[model samples]
Every structure is written in C-alpha cells, then in structure tokens.
Target: MSPQGHPWQKQPDWRILDTQFGSGNTFLATWLTWLEDADHPRLLHYVAVCQQPCSASELIKHFEAHPKLASLALELSHHWFGLLPGFHRFLLEQGQVVLTLCVGEPLPMLRAQQFEADAIELTLPHTCQDELSWFLKAIAHCCRRGTRLVMRHADAAETPGWPRVLTQCGFTLEPMKSDGDDSYRQKPSSFSGYFDPAWTLQRTRPTTKTGPLPVLRCAVIGAGLAGAAVATSLARRGWQVTVLDQAETPAAGASGLPVGLVLPHVSSDDCTLSRLSRAGVRMMLQQVSELLNVNRDWAPSGVFERQIGGTPKLPLTWSSEGTQWSANGHPDGDVALGSGLWHPKGAWIKPAALVKAWLNQPGITFLGNAAVTDVRRQGPTWVLSNNSSEMLCEAECVVFANANGAFELLQKMKHSALDTQAQESHLPSKQGMLGLLSWALHAEPEEARFAPFPVNGAGSIVSCVPTENGLTWFMGSSYQPDAQLERSDQENHLRNLEHLKELLPSLAQKLAPVFEAGTLHAWKGTRCITADRLPVVGPLDATDQPSLWICAGMGSRGLSFSVLCAELLVARMGAEPWPIEAKLARSLEALRA
Candidate 1:
C-alpha cells in the first residue's frame, strides 16, 4: 500500500529475477501463485542464472515427488536438458509464463544483460565471498528504483555482500522477522548517481518491444515450412495472418521433403550452427509433440551420427543416456568403426505434414496457387501482386518466408515500382544447376530393411513410413546447386542408394533389388541456403522498420529450424519476449543488411 492509503499495485507485466536458480523452486512457487491469483499479471516473466543445471531426470524426479507440480514439472523436464552455456527460454502456460534460464557463472551472466527487474531474489552462493562486491554491482545493473529484493542465507549476518555492499549498490536494508532472511528495497537515486551506471549517454535508446502496440496483422509470403510456421505462431498470438505460396500446395519447396532428421550438430568449437541446431531441435520437438502423429509422421527414434575415417574430435565427448564413449572404444560393441553422437531427442519428421498442420491454425489463411510475383510498401500497407501485375492482397506488415523465392520476392518488393524489365535487370542473378530427387517418389522396399533408428551420415535415411501406396523408406536428398526444381533423376537415386549402402552395408545389400530397379523413393525440392548455411530469421531491416520481416534460408534443416525461426519472427513482430538468447537471435538475423 502507498502512503496515500491506496493499494499499491504492480503491472501485469511483472518481471522477477533470481540471482541463482538452484532448482527452480522460486519459479515454481511464483507460477503456482500466479495460477491461484486471478488478478495476476498477464505475463509472468522470470530470469534466473545457473552455472550447471541438474540432470533432466533428477529435476523431473524432484518435481514428481510433489503432487502439485507433477504435470508442469514433467513439461519442464522435457526442455531442461540443454547443457549449453547460454540462455534457454521455456514457454509455459502457452507462453503466458516465460522462463529465461541463463547457464553461466553468476557475475558474467548478470553483467551481460540489460533489463529492469520489479522483484529480485538474491540467492547467491556463499562460496563466492571474494567477488561479493562485483556480484552486488552486477545485480544493481538490473535493479530500478522501487524494486524490492529478498535474500536468503544460512547466516544473515554472514552474507557475502553485507550492508556495505548493498548500500554501495543503492539498496536500503531492512530488518526481517526471520534471522536468515534479509530484505531490501532499491533506494532513490538519479540515473547517473549509482556507481558504474549501466547506461551510456545516447541520443536514443534501443527498442526491445515485448508485445504488439496496436495492431497484429501480417502477410507471410510462401506456404512452406518456414512460412507456415511463422503464420501459425502469429495466428496463435491472435494475429490475422495470410500466408501466400507460389505453388499449388504447401511445403512445395525444400520443405516438401517427405522425411528429414531433426538432429543437433556438434563441432569441436561449439560453432554457432551447432548451438543453433541444438536449440532449434528443442523448439521443433515442442511443436511436434503438441501437433503431429507420433511414430507415424514423426518419431523420437533418435539419430546416430557416425564419424568415419579421420573423425575430427568434437568439443564435447559423445554420450547418450549418461554413458560417454569414444570411437576408439566402440562402446556399443558394434562392428561400425567410428564413434557416433546419439541425439535421443532428435528424430525423423515428415515435413509436409507439419507444414499443412501449421497452416491449419485458426486466423491463418493459406492462399495456394496464387503465385506472388511482387511486393511493394505503400504509405502504410504492403501490397502483393502476381506476375501479370494483378493485385493479390495488402497488409500492414510483410514477411518473406518462401525458401529461395524469399530472396527473389524481397527483391521484387524492394523494386516493385520499376519497369518489369528494369526490375529484372536490377535483380541479383544466379546461374547454377543442382542435384537429385525431391518430393517422395515411392518404391516398395522390404520392411526389415529399415533401421531401428534413423541414420545420418553423408546423405541420410528414414525407415518405416506407411504411405498411401505401401510401406516405403524416404531417402536420397541431393543437396546440389545444379539440380532442377521438382524433377527427379534416376541417377540421383543411384547416388542416394550408394550413400545408403555406405551407412548400412548389409541393409543396402538387402535392398539392392530396389536400388538396381531404380525404385528407391525420393523428392526434388530446392533448398534455400545462406552463405553461412544457417536459417535467416528476424527483420529484413534492423532499424526497426515498420513493415518488413523475413524467415527463410532454412536449407536442409527446415524441419528442425522452421519452428524456432518462426517463433523468433513472430515474437519480434508481436512484441513478445524472444524464446532464445539475444546472441543467438542476432546470429539468425535474416542473413541480410
């Protein structure tokens, strides 16, 4: 309550921060409290730092012991296993509740971020006595005037950052009823009054919008996986989304692949791609679990990545189910001569089903066979047109999400006013012919030929797909720049069969009849690839432009990456808290200026 005898209230956009996320008990309590309070904030945001999170199974066990938290804890456990040293966002309660978990040493994590906290829970470790001042200073970086903080320790008087450090950080300590409990409130201070203020003199501050200000409407071009995913995310957020595709059907591009693996990539240096893939695989799994037929269109059969001759050393050791083994040991006691990384969460997914499902969301309209040839920004709305210059639709914001077509559509949108010939002349030209089959061309292969788990080697293979015709294996995706669009060549089948033979010699030999008969299933679709070979997400222009966004360049990982890319794009558009760390978000930025 305020001094004026009125109830003091906090905004529904309440943000709480914890210096330490020991086991997420603070988060669970707060969440339960929110669930019980009808007037609670519409968005409950919690940010916590942890050096090392407990294993997923352990966390799940801890939560399961409590009957109240059993269900939600199980949900959390699904996303709790990422050991990467970065921020991980978990969307709970359908994103109304958000948990941003940063894995890093306390001081470094706090120093790297700039956000205002309405409530702070100081649960710093007692062992870090030498760096007490630094920790307090970093905590102050996120504190604003009027913020309330509570610290818990075994001995209140023996806290590493005593009253002196708290005072130095502009905190007014108050006596608490419990001896081990210390409470404080942010003291009144000028912007520059605090020592080592976070802000620097600037003409304008950066905008970190967390939700739509006034309107939520967009036209997402391309009905492939990326576009459909973007459209679905926006539609889920109450946005009216219109998805346009040049083809008669969705996933008619590279996303048309009948089967693809959602496996994480690992590099010795933990490269950006590997990190992005890990996070991406997690995001896709969430969507897949919620929507899509398990063991039919998709399954968590896990993926084994074999490292053959001259196998490069990975930054992290290979381990599955907590059992670490190297190639030299062949820990599984297999005839295979190389060590492999097992992605238990990674699995095979039929891309087309996902694309169709995503587009089926309420408020999302898919316009197929209505090829979009040009786009232009009017005073406020973005106009779409066909190749005949016929108007298609107009909307406030436009998202380019069609694989390689995104690159071309954006060019048309940027120069829509110019003469058709002039526009073509100004457009970037690429003359290349690329490889093998796209779209599932089926052949009946014996069911036993399928593997117990999906195998990802040079090309890859998926087993046990019950298609309309018969039981078949979808394989042989040639990542070639010289391949024609939507055309399958028998030679590509030979190549795919050869790659399959290399991965599973005995199985390929058993399926030799199908290979020799040129009856192996295949698909032909052009995959969009950035120079970096990573998905391009976020705004096309970084200057906070009003009407342009992009989610393309998915390449071969379309199934694995489309959901996250779409998630980020929609989050940015609707002003929602991003689902991934800022560093990673920046890396996936549209691959443009």
Candidate 2:
C-alpha cells in the first residue's frame, strides 16, 4: 500500500495480514516505513502466517543485503523462537509494533485470528493454488468494508482464475497500472482491490478493528498482578486507569510472592491449560524484558523440572519449536541433572516488581487500601464502594481482579447477570484459598551441589536470590489446602523439607540440618485456585455493552497467566485482535457454562 493512498494513514492503529511469511522481508520493510513516518499510526500490527518457520540465523541471514533493515531483522530474530503451530505474538518497538506470527496452514490460521485487516498482502506458493479460493474466503472473513487487498504471483498466466476467486470472496478488484512498482515487493503480476460484497456476507463472528477505543475512566480493583496488568494494558490504549486495592501497597496479596516461576505447563495432549501457559509465558517474558530489571527483578535463567518417577514428557505434537521452548531432558553442565524437562524460555520473576512497573505507567493511578466491598451500575458508569458504603470510585468500566475477593464481591452484587451465572456454576465451591509455605536459607548447604537455575517438580527451589539477610536459596512452597493448613512455622518447614527430599534426595540430605535447626526464613501466601484450574477472564456483566469484567483465579500461575489474560480482557474491550486463538481464549471466558 502506497503512503498517499493508505487507508490507515490517519487511523489510530493499522493492521495488515500477510498470507505467508516467506522471509519476513515484507514485515521488516513495513516496520521501517512506519518508523520513518513522522505521523505514523499509534500502533502497527502485522499479522503473518508461517508453516515450519525458519531458525533465527536463517531469518537474520535473509537481510544481509538490506543493510538498513538488518538491525530490525536481528531484533525480530531474537524473539522468533518457539514457532509452534499457534499464534505467537512479538511486541517490538516497546509494544507499539505487534507482529503476530500464526504458525500453521494458511486457511486454518486465518480462521483462528479475529482482526479486521486494513491491508492484505496475498502471496501463495504454487502448491497452494488448489486451495487459493479457500484461503481468500478465509481472508475475506477478517476484512471490513474498504479493506485494501493486493495479490502477487510469479506469473499471472498460471493462475488466471485467481481474479474470479477474489470476486467470489467478496473482494472488488481495482485496476492496476501496467508495470507498477510494488512498494513492498515488485512481482511480475500484481492485482489490487478492496473488500466490497454485493450480497449479505455471513461469518461465524464479526471481525474486530485495531483500537484506540475512546479513552474513558476505568477503575481496576486490586493492585496485584491481574489488576496491574489490566491497568497497564488499558493505560497503553489511552484509558484513564485507577488501580484500587485493599492492601497498603501494590502486590500486597498473593502477588507479593518474592519470586515465582514463569514456565509452561506440559501435558501429553497439549491441553488447553498447557497451550495457554505457553502463550502466557511468551507474553510474560516480553513484558519482563520491556519493564523489569533482568537478573534482579526477573531472570530468564531457565527452569529444570524433575518428573520424579518418570521423565518429563512433551506433547505428541512436539517439534523443533517445542525444543526451543522446552526440552525432554536437562542441558549439560548442571550439578542437579536428572530425568526432567529443560524450559529454556522459563524464568523467575518478582511479581511485585512487575506489578509496580505496570501500575506506574502513564494514565494509571494506584490507590491502595481502597478495599472495594461492593460494585453496582449507576446509569452508564460502574460505582465501586468500600465496606462502609463509601464510594471508592466511579468509572465507565470496572474490572475485578482480587482473586478470591472477586467471588465475594460478585456475590454481593445480587442483581448482576454474571453473579447468577457464577452462583450456578458453583464458583465458590469451585474455588478456594490454597496456602503455600516456602523457606529460604541465608547460606547454601552445599554451594558446589546447588544448581544454577531453578528446579521444580514435587516442589521447587530457587537458589541465590538477593534478600535483606544476604544471598538466599528458596525451596519448598509446600502446597497446603485450607483444610490441611498448618499454622506452625516448624510444621511448614518440615513439609517443605519433605518436598525437597522428594524432588532432590541428595540435596535434601544436606539441607536437613538447616530445617532441623529451624533457622530458615519462611514465606507464606494464600493463592486462589479454581476447579478447572484456568484463570477467569472476560466480561462479567452485559456482553453487548460490558462495563464489568473479572480477571482472577490465576492460582500459582499468576506470573504466567496475568499478562496474557489482561491483554485478552482489554483486547475484547477495545475490539482489537485476541492475542491467542479464539478457542483458547474461550477456555478462559468469565461466563463459560
């Protein structure tokens, strides 16, 4: 698309859909163009579909001749790993430029996405000619009126019927000047068009536009991971966000955990939760890279998980991309080697740091100790009140992200449509406070035997995190449901020691003396977990004009799921493309049956 005639020239954000990402040259060029433009759109989203994506070296090699684009290509290559068959979102230019790589078959991948493309660049390999009609039909499903389309092929004579296919797909072709130079690429034959159908076009769901959805007042209850994430996501979209919390400081809840593992959950079937965790970890890592202090607040040092009886197994669909994300066995040079999985993309993040960073974003105001006890609709605004019926804040939108507190608040809103659904779904019985106990030692029992990275399985151990008492090694985090809760610190330490023994027998023996001495520091927190084990996300009240939302029930995967769920929530509100696939997003729906 030329600058003069670009449809998204004056729009808040522009979205383009690329059918195949052969070398990523088009994406690089588009990004460069956006960067050079003095008045570029607020956001530039380039969604591309790839089948069996190349390695980072291969991607970087393609730009060897294009000196101007080489640095951009290198930046893109760094986050190009884990290109499994799913939607992989890359946040470039500090989240301004979004590159969503849909890795799979073109038609199926296009169906999985839900954004309205401002421009379309179609270039299919010769092998895809048979499915060209189907591909165009799927592409049309994501187009809006006046959506510009361009088709390029090596030889137009080979595919004379493509024009007919475009017509059937509801794309009206535009006349092109002979031998016109395509700004992005100059192919032998090129056809330009816009989406304009004659008859009523049917679709499973409406396409969503990239957004700067009218900035309004938004009150996010809970200054923890979920709330802070939502606040940041909304604030980035220009919303005035007020983060209200019961505690005196941000992340003064379960999110107050000093350090937590951000790793993917592996299952044989690559179940919904597993897929969701992978997406979440990817998003969380990107956020950490942009917002937190690496090696201090967080570290992408990787995690080794011992499977105890059996070796850690990846899903049957695991491929090279899976290896980049997680391997079946640990890497070399590990003191605590065993039959476990190595998650190279895994990390340990101090949730409070991330929460603080998110809350500190522009347009976001953090108000602690607000303790929103009741929520109700007043005309078009959502009114949040405290325990004494005193108003906390009134905003155009409200999101409950206080974990178990969300259920209690929702229960108080008797007339809420979502409240009825929550009650019928047995949300209370489906959720509970799960107390966890972790202990840290001022010194390592055996420094030489300590693994450099975190190890998890029966329980978890993170060695050598800086604390007020100096360097410390954290372990255990013994899981104790409310019923089996132990109030004594010694009992918790014993339980944590038991977990260490199960996870690493040899190391446990060395640390047994420390546990016996009761000199280890204890850290305790209660996490909210749901029966299905997935976080609740999406609109809680009216779906048509939703004003109330809930993003909670993160369990122990708060670091893994918070950013993803926050993006999903704000994406729905702004009508932007969902970060994950529609089916995967549905699993975390707040009002699911």
Candidate 3:
C-alpha cells in the first residue's frame, strides 16, 4: 500500500497491493488504516507505476511545504528517499506488519508477482483507458481468492461499472460506504473475491488451557540506567522484579559519570544503529521526563559534533535534511541542524539520580552488593550465586546489565559463544576530563550558568551545576584501554589537559599555571563498545538454562540508547509492539544466542 498515512492506521492479516501511487494518498490511507486495526494484515506489498519518477529530495521538499499533509508527507518522503529499488521490506509492530515496496510499472510487476493479498488499492484516472484495463487485469491476477479491492474514481464518468467488471473477473461486490454530495457521489466498494468461507468468515475462539499460566519472576543484575529502566518496565507490566548491583548504589559503573551526552549517533544513510539511536533518544526523553521529576539536572542541551582531522562532514542530526546537508557539504561543511533533532530533547541527566528514581517505584526490589558469580537453572527458576557460594537471587527471567562483566558471566555459563564479536578502541585523545575551574575573576552568580560551545573544548560539560565546594568543570572524557582502569588520576588528568588545549587553546593558556599546581581534579571512565559499535540488548542463550536476557554495550550513547533498549526488552517479554522497527531490535540482540 502507498504510505500516504501512518502504516499502523489499519491492521490486517493478508498481503496488500497498490497499483497507482500519486502523492501516495490511497496508499497512505490504507497504511494508516492497517496500523489502527491490530489484525489488519500480515504482509503489505506496495506497487506503483511512476512514468515520471520524482527525485526523493524534490518530493520531500514539496511535502515539507504542505500544511495538512506535511507530517505524513514528510514521513513518506523519508521512506521513499531511503528506498532503493528491488524488493525491500521493513518489519513494523514486531514483525506483525511487513511492508514491501516495489517501485516499477504496477501492471507488469503485478502480473509477474504471485502473492495472495487481503486488500488492494487502485488510484486510477477518470477514464477507463486501455492502461486502466491492463492494470485491472494485472491486479485481478495478483489478488487471491478472498482479496478486497478499494478503488477511487477520479470522476463520475470514469467510474467504469466496476461491479460488472469485478463480477466478470469472479469477484462478488459488497457495498460498504460512500462520501460526497449527490452531484459528485464518489462511492467506495468492498468485495470478497473467491474467498474461503471457512477461513475468512469463521470466528476464532480462545483456546481452553488445561493448566494455570506460570508465574513470571524476573531479575536484573545491574541497577544502572539500562537495568533500572528494564526492571521498571517489567514491574509496571505486573512482573515481580529484583534488581541486583555489586556497588552500594546503582549507576556506579561507567554510568556513574556526573553527566552524559544525550543525542542521536546518526550516520549518512540511516543505518540500523543510527535509526534506533534516533528513535531511542526521542522515546527516552519523552518517557523519562514524564516518569520522574528529575528535569532540573536533565536539561536538553543540543550536542555540537565537529569532524576532526578532515573526516567527512558528520550529520548534526538524524534526519533527511541533515543527511542532505552533510552530503552536500562533501569534504567540509561548517555544520547543519538535523530535521527532528531537538536540543531540548537531547538533555543531560544525573545518571545515578535517574536510576534511583526507577527503583523508587512499587513492585521493584533493589539488592545492593548482591553480585552473582554463577547462574544455574532449577526447573523454571533461575538461581544466582556469589563467590562465597551464597545465593544471590532467584527468578524465572534474568537480565545481565553489566557492561564488560556480561562477557565474564556468559563465559562462566559455558556459553562463551555469546561473546561480542568485535570491540572498539577510542583514541585516548577523544576522552574528556571534567573538573572544577574557578573563573579568573569571580563574577555574578548568574554568570556561572553552563555556556554552549560550538566545538569540543576543555570547559566542563556541566559548568552550570554548582556544588557546595564550587562550580564543577567536568573534563577528560579521553579514551583509554579498558585495562588502563588502574591508571593514576594524575596521568589521565595531564592527557585530558593536552586534549583540552587542542580543542580550546585559549583555555589551555589560561589554565597552564593551575595545571602545574595540580589544582585540577580528574576522574576517568572507559566507554565500553562492541565490534560493530552498536548496543547489545535482548535475550541470552545458555545450555538448559532458564530465561536469560542481556542489555549492554551502550558505549558512549548510553543516555540516548539505554531507556529504549529497556523498552525493547519489556515489549519482547510482554509480546507487545516494539518501540523500534523489528530489524533494528534484532540487530541489537546479542548475536550468538
């Protein structure tokens, strides 16, 4: 179906076919209809014959200008622009809806293709021309025995007695609804063609169970952002949840950082990670802000990323406009704002505070210092233990939220096959060091607010955040080997100062004396990454083990990807629609299991 409206508008259970796609109106209407109805269709095949195929760029620009159709039009234009001819499919609503876009001459394409569709839409011109007859014939051949065709007549004279034509083609018409005045009288017809009465007409009855449903008790091994989010989601859905953390408090790992950046880590053509990160950021900001009153420390400050060392221009946001700007700039572009990129949406959050908020709710149990060194299943329940042979927790479902620690646990389970295939190393220069920097001259308190910078610099990301001691200037986000975790603070601080000088020379010059005097304090945290540089969030496999899940490898975009990953796991557990496309969800799942 043409994506004129939202694809989830009407849900169906069979394939869908579309012949004409002018402005994708009928296609979008059907898509939106399918989206609204949960059981609309299992598969949707959209075919359009465009003799004059408009450039995706031009179509998007046109859609942006319209009022009523602007939103839906922009969405469709994005999908179209992202399309590459040949059968391309997208999994929506957790594989419930599969969208197949076929760009070519619809009549010939339909004739060559053989798929049973529950619905078909034709947006033909007013006259019953030869082309229309050919298109109708092709559509008839493609429609299965029970297919429903929704055709829109351009004019009254063009309404070529479809009832008779359909009857001749072995289709029985069932008039549904009509819109328009007597003079215009444009009517819509629904027909069940050559359908199996047993399959289409039969009412489904619920299966009678012989036993009671099993109780679902889930445990999350980390209480950081990802674990907290996942546990909260499961708890909200009526699952008994227990959150375990080795630290005294949650978010004490890499997530313990005072502040973290929240923005879509986008790419040129919207890869799986880029798309999920974009959607994840949006969903996180919306849900987090609503669930907790922690907005004070979490303000949406836009991220300013610049290409270093003559790298190709990076997109400022994850939108078609951002991609165009980056592509058009070629080797060098000052910078461009993304289409859906909102600075307010990509805010800074106190990680620990957020995690604590998630644990404060009912139905969630927080257990600190309850490290699990081993996991074994006892029938349907999973049991965890510590090094001292003490029982940690028991549950039907278990999720691993520890970053690098996840690998160790999986290895212990003899399921080392679940190891992340690739790992990334950030050049130490890219790491940031945060500290408190006293102004050369003490000014009014209002001047202490954090100021946005156009490029990476030595200035603290959370300069505005004040503590009883003084204004905090966080720096030294430099990348170091995970093994360097034991390195001294002084060494890391000097490295961070060097990087600071590169980003802002003036700041280095002004702080030279302070640096020499060791007046600058520093902390270091290594950003964990996968070989593919994407997060791993979903089920884990263990030989004869009870339910096991994992939510890790968030890297530096934790604030942006964490909450959404939690939502994905929750949806998977509840068998509900995923917040992201199905392909993306699978892409983030741990590969081995």
Candidate 4:
C-alpha cells in the first residue's frame, strides 16, 4: 500500500496486516506478490488473525486446489502446527518474512498485539456488516498516521455508507469507480494504490539510522548465559561481538551447570516474571531447537514440577490435564506432586552447551580468562581494563553481563570516579582500588545485598540434569544472597538435599543412600538478582544508552530468559520490534527498578 501515486516498489521492513485471515488466500497472494516485486520490502512482517483457524492439513489440503499457492502453502505447513491457541511466530525466508499468526477471535488478538502497520486489508460482505464495529476498534488500535486501509465489499452498492463509517475510524476513503465505472474522491476504491509504491521510509522497523545498520563492534563481559545470549543476538544482527569472561570458558558460572530446567512460572495474578518467563520460554524453545541438539543438549519433551507447602494456585492458562502426580506415588523416591501440573513444552537444557553454541555464531568471539575490571566512557568509546591497569579491550558498545560483579563495578565506578580531567579521575574500578572500595563498602553484603523484588518466595529446583556421570537431579539453589563463590560445593549439596527433604520428604528418603555415601553432587554459583527477579535487559537509563547496556540479574531463570532478554536487547539497540510488548519491555528495563 503506497502513499502517493507511486507504483509499489521495494520498501524494507513493511508490515501488512490482515484482519480476517480466511483460508490463507490473502497471505499467499501477498507473499507471492511480494516475491514478484523486485522492490519488495526486505523484511515483511505479515500478521494474520483467524478466529478458528483450520488444522495445518486442512489448510494445506484446501490450498492444493490452487496451483499458484501450493508450494508456498507446503512450506508454510512445516511451521503451521506451531499455531496453537494464541500467538505463534514463524520465521521464513531466513527471517526476511515473519508471520505472526494469532489463533483466536480478531478483536482480542488485535487488542493484545501492539504494532504499527503500514497496510491493513479487510474483506467484508456487501450486505449487512455484522462484525464491523469491533473490527474497526481493533484496527484503530494498530494503525499509524499514514497507514492505508483496503476494504473489499462484495456488494459495494448494498453496503450503503460503508466508506462513511470508515471515516469515523480515522480512515480517509479514496474515491472509487462506481458499481460499473471509475474515478471519485476519497474512498476504498479499486485496489489501485494498494500494491503501488507510496512508502518511502521504513519507519516502523527498528533502525534509528537512515540506512542499513552499520557494522559495529561490541564487547560483552561474562560468558555465562546472559553474556553469551547478548553476544549471540548482537552477532546475529551483524555486530562484531567479543565475549570476555574471567572464567576459562563460557558458561563457567551458574550457566556452567550440567542441566537447567526451562519452565514457566505460574501465578494466580500471572506476575511479571510469570508472563516474562512464558514469553522467554516460548522464544527459547525455538532457539534451543535450532541451535543445540534436541533431547541431548536440549529437551522440550516436558517437565513435572511438584509443589511444596501447597502449589501456589497457578493461573488458568497453565492448567493442564491427563498427567497428575502425587508426592507419594513412588514410595522409594516418593515425591508425588499429589496433583501437580505437567509442562508439555518444559524442557531440560545444557546451559553450557547453549552458551558455547551462541559464542560460535558468525560474528561472535569468546575471550577466555580475560577479566574486565571496569569500564569508562571516553568520548565515544568505552575503555575496559584489568585490575592490573592493563587495557583489556575497547569498543563503542559495552554490555555488562558478569552478574553481581556488574553491580559491584557500577558501585565502584559511581563512588570512586571524580570530576577531574585526568584518566585517574574517570574511574577507579579499573585499578586495584575498585576492588578495595567494593570490599570496604559492603564487607558484609547486607541481607539486602542483591535480592528479588517482592521476593518470589518461590524457591527453585532442578531435576533430570544430564552430567558427566549420568542423568542427575539438582535441586534447591539456596538463595545465599551476597554469598559469593565461597560456599563449599559439599555444603550446598547437603543444603540441596535438605531442600528435597522439605519439598518432598519421601523422595529425600529414597535418595538418602546418596547422602549417606556422599555421592550427592552439587554446585555453587551466584545468581545476579535485582529488586525484581526479571533481568535488566535494556539500557541503563531505561531509554538511551548509545553504547552502554546491561543484561544481568536473571536470578536462576537465566536459561529460560536469556534468549528473550538477548533479543530484546538487540531490538532496543537496533530499534526493531520487540519480541515481547512495550510495557513488558519497560518492566525489564535495567534502570526501571
């Protein structure tokens, strides 16, 4: 849908929305037309809404009749099953074309989604318009100033004043060729300008620049899930990312664990973390399947979580059937959920492997044993250095993902930096004093050192984590707030054993032999947390951070939230549509809390 008398030409990052995606005909036609046009948008976000979408086979079978749409429909069929009941995102043409299919009533779907559409297409009957009101309301929510609306009325003559109604919805109708002839004023006339080139700028897409995103270099501290995910995301966007960590290799921190569970947090109110977790998990499922070995490095088969002290009444969305567990089912390993819900999409993952995979991406490089002590803004670049005053590296963009170390560094940078012109005045953390300042400031990290906001009160448990020995279960990552990496592994393992005893006594008893034999394995790693458990995913200012950003404080949900947080960070940096909503993005803003 062009703006002026221009024939539609290539316009990168154009959005085409179909209010009623019936039988997939409109989507197919638009896709084919886009393919035919040499000047089509570089990225086409085709959002389709269907109230009761047919099954993939049903839709495919119907398309078989149309030779023109067969091939495209077949390719679409592969990802068709992903369309469950709500929103399903499918990437095609290597992400050039993205299809966000909403399987629900049009009104709710449109209301839930936030996007600025360049073109809106709707087909209505010529007779009485039954669902016209709600449709217009939903359309208005997503339309921008220059958005063009295309309406096809079967009986334009019978539907008297349809164009007039459109005007009330803020849509100016261009003149149309009467029932037989042509040429009028403003109305939803023939599809003349619908495909014509009227668009000049790719305004909706995320890229603040006038042209393509420039080849940029960035340095990400920490090789754990958070840092690796951020590095991977930026690299995917053509940014040269160097992932530096003090550890010898990636995922050597909490992300180094052999197995981590990926599941959604459910709550009656569906708290922010719950919502963020679900979205994060949904996105992670795709990334893991694409990047790591399924069932080996990753598994989406499902998970069973046994609640203790009574399952915190889950939201209606998490209600599952068929699989019921009881904390007493297995007397030997007796941890029957008594009636725990099953997470069909919940899976176990090797966080270490995933981190390495991300680090291997085209533009990503991992620097091991490279500990970055502090960062200082020097004009346009940030200078990173080791404790010995040795320059580690410098880049225009610097992201802090080294967990609480980031918090410590920030505190050092703030309290120590003076208003002097000399380099020594810029920052002290780069020197040995940074560490001394941090230790002196909080020698006994108060109980409030780094804690969850509102405190989840919800403890964590890991089960069925694959390790060097065999399939092992890990539980109870005791939130030893401010407890750095000094805790003994044996002590934490024993602590975890106690957690099992409290969570599921019977199972604890069944596994008593391991404790008796001292064979119970455990690991200790610090989890970066904030006032809220959600990761600080955006700029430090909640808005602008030309070169500085943070993707930390994931707590223990690092595995579940890494990919989503990474993508959100990238979208923010590149100015693209976020994988989640705007409000949710705000909730995860690093500086918001």
Best by TM-score: 2
CA-lDDT, candidates in order: 0.66, 0.80, 0.55, 0.62
Backbone clash pairs for candidate 2 read none
lDDT of 2 at 390: 96
Q: In candidate 4, what are the lDDT values of residues 40-85, reduced to their tens digit?
A: 7666778888777766787788777667677888877755543434
Badly placed stretches (over 4 Å) of model 2 are 1-5, 125-130, 177-189, 204-213, 333-336, 415-429, 444-448, 483-486
Which number leads on lDDT?
Answer: 2
* Model 3 worst lDDT window (10 residues): 203-212
The estimated TM-scores of all candidates read 0.81, 0.93, 0.60, 0.72
Between candidates 1 and 2, the TM-score winner: 2
What lDDT is reached at residue 207 by model 4? 26
- Cα RMSD of all models vs. native, in order, equals 5.9, 2.7, 10.2, 10.0
State residue 329's C-alpha deviation in candidate 4, in Å: 11
Ranking by TM-score: 2, 1, 4, 3
lDDT by residue for model 3 (1-593), tens: 32334332444234556655555555544555556555444434354444334566665555454444455555545434333222333333333333444445555455544344556665554446555566666666555566665655534466666555555555565544543211211234332334322333221221110111233788888877778888877765567899998887888777777766666554555567656665666556655565545535565554444333443234445444344222322122223311122232346666767788788877899999888888776766778889897888898888888777765666566323333222111211122212222222223453332235223323333444444455455655656555444555666566666765655556556555656666665554556677667777765532323267788877777787887788677655543334554445657866432
